[model samples]
Target: MEATFVIVGGGIAGVSCAETLAFFEPDKSIILLSESSLIKTVINLHAITRTLTQFNIQEMESSEFSLKHPNITVIHDTLVEINDGEHYILTSTNKTIKYEYLCLCTGAQPKLIPQAELFEEIIGIRDTDSVEIFLQKINRAKKVAIVGNGGIASELAYKIKNTQVHWIIKDKHISATFVEPGAAEFFLSSLNKDVQEEQVTKRMRYQEEYSHRSGAALGPDWYKNLIIKGAGDLNIPSEIKIHYETEISNIQRSNNSPYALEVTLSNGDKFTCDMIISATGVTARKSFVSKNELELSNTGEIKVNEFMQTNLQNVYAAGDVCCANWKLAKHWFQMKLWTQARQMGSYAAKAMVGHLNNEEVLQDFCFEMFAHSTKLFGYKVILLGLFNGQKLGTNYEILIRMTKGLEYIKFVLEDNKLQGAVLIGDTDLEEMAENLILNQIDLSPYGDDILNPDIDIEDYFD
Candidate 1:
């Protein structure tokens, strides 16, 4: 079997690449091989700012890809080996397919806690199945411990009610992956806030059935609708105890306590919980590709250039599976987020098509700045550029404005130019903030007036 283009992995990156390819090159044959029977598709894509986007991810039947694109064929198969020299790949089912262009979107896997023996008692929430498993465990759990300082850990700390949460973070504050100490303090108040009654609003949906294999990592808003509750009744207010600047020293099954497990923290504190959710983070998944066949980064990620092309001819990679080895735009940095996955996938498709046509292709404008939007503790969170003054050393100024329980806005200014911003709540400053950062407008003359309540920053910018 052969095709003009063969994409491995059915995550957002692969599906988006295939969709874009079909739209641009209708005559070319494309084959999308996936280990999972279900594929993820992004819907309701909304451009909140030039670089920031909001979208809902839907898990659809793999057959939908072929039905949507007459030139594209979807196959449920696992990629086993890639023969770069022969320009062919071997599948797990003993099938060989040759392609002129190959894109690998095999995303990353969770970096679980380093206890090999207690793997069954720990859960790393990445995909739908993992979330289901977490829900099942929490239903019968009285107390659960979560380890990590990233998005998943932060969200779980706030969303998991009725169960006492032992949020263990190696950082001094919460949500360190997205916000600073001030913002973390702002979010601290919401952790124990009365749980809001469930609302029947539109939300991203998930469907799962026994298939040939598991599906891709879930996209944004993966837990928006799910009923995340614990064994305690509704009247009991949520309880969360944060262990800052510490990590898990050891974990073992409890002998005398009623709890299922005993966890010892690096600070010499010990606690017993029913289970532990390790959101420690993810590492790139590159085990399928032989080291001799592809150039890899020091961190085991496939190394790709600006065009998303690998060292091997006709081979490319995108999303979490690959690292951006090229010089990045000043304001843009890479994060293993769904937004970046979509952008990388789309850009890779254009790059591939341009290579085929011998046409010059420029980098996408979205890469000019880094932006992300997510909800934590029921508040809208927007991050732009170097929001926390990353890489700026100690030579930056921060401006902040806060209205308790309403909004918290922060701006990172370097040499009077907007370098980054964190807009929490519905501050309605994302567009203006993005423009200020992109245009490098100097706001020195405005002084503290920029964040003054009386002054409309947007109007001044306009």
Candidate 2:
């Protein structure tokens, strides 16, 4: 089969790239190759700020998508080989695909615990099938151990009920992945509070028989439909025990013990649990091989230039499979986020279209600032550029205003200019915070009054 554009994977990046290509070049034929039957699509997107956006994710059958877009053909097949020299790829089923422009959006796989392979009972926090498998395991589990502190583990800790969660992290506090310690402290209280149970967002989910191959990594509200509970009564909230500054050092089968496995920690503590969910993180997936292959970053991801093009001619990569190799913007850095995936994918399509039309495509303005919106512990969270004071060295100062059970706001400032911000809860300051970071206006005159509760911050801006 031949197409003007051939995209790989069915995750957010691949889908976004394919859709964008179809929209721009309606007459051009596009083929999307995937291993799974379902494809993830973003819906109900609301931009909280110019750059910060929130969206609900839906996983639907790939066939449904192709029927809607007659110009785009969706092929359910795994990419196995690449021949950049001939601008073609080979799938697992021996289907030969020739393309004018090719994009590899092959997502990442879970970076499981080092000892994961030795165990027959460990589950890597992954796609719907695995998560469903996890739920089935936890259904009979009285105690569950989660081995990661990233978004997936944190969310699992909050959502799972009627079980004892031993959350092992190498960091000092919970959710070190997204927030600083101060913000972590602010959210600490809500960790156990079951005030107004989190209502699951209803969505389509495939059963265990959906397809043995794991579908794309899930996105926003992927667990909403899953009522994750343990062997205990559903009314009882899940209990979380944090073992900070520690990691799993070893795993061994219990010797006729009731619990299935015994996990030894790096700090020399041992615990028994029915199952271990390794949310350790993800490593870029690179199962397919090319004749010359593609240039990779130090982190084993495809290195893409400012235009998302790889070293190989007419080949590009995006999302978790690729890393940005260009000089990053002051406020922007790479994180393997669904939002970034969407942004990179869209920009990649623009770059490809511009290349074909011989038009100049300036860097997207979204790159000028980093923004993300998410929900944690039932609180709205918005992160804006350099939120952690990253890359600023020790020259930056932090300003914070936090109210217990209400909101927590932190600002990273350098040279009297706003650099980044972390806004937890509905502070309604994302727009102002985003503007300040982008404009880089001096806030010295306002001094500490800028965050004063009495003064309306928006009034000064107006």
Q: Report residue 427 deviation for candidate 2 (angstroms).
A: 0.5
Error of 2 at 290 (Å): 0.7
Using all chains and alpha carbons, the TM-scores for the candidates as numbered come to: 0.96, 0.95
For every candidate in turn, the CA RMSD to the true structure comes to: 2.1, 2.6
lDDT of 1 by residue, 203-264 (tens): 23333332335557766566766778888767877789999999999988899898989999
Q: Taking the tens digit of each residue's C-alpha lDDT, what string does model 2 give over 370-456?
A: 887767777777889999999999999999999898889999999999999998877888889999999999999999888888999
lDDT of 2 at 414: 98
- Candidate with maximal TM-score: 1
Count: clashes, candidate 1: 0
Q: What is the lDDT of residue 244 in candidate 2?
A: 95
Cα lDDT, model 2, residue 74: 92
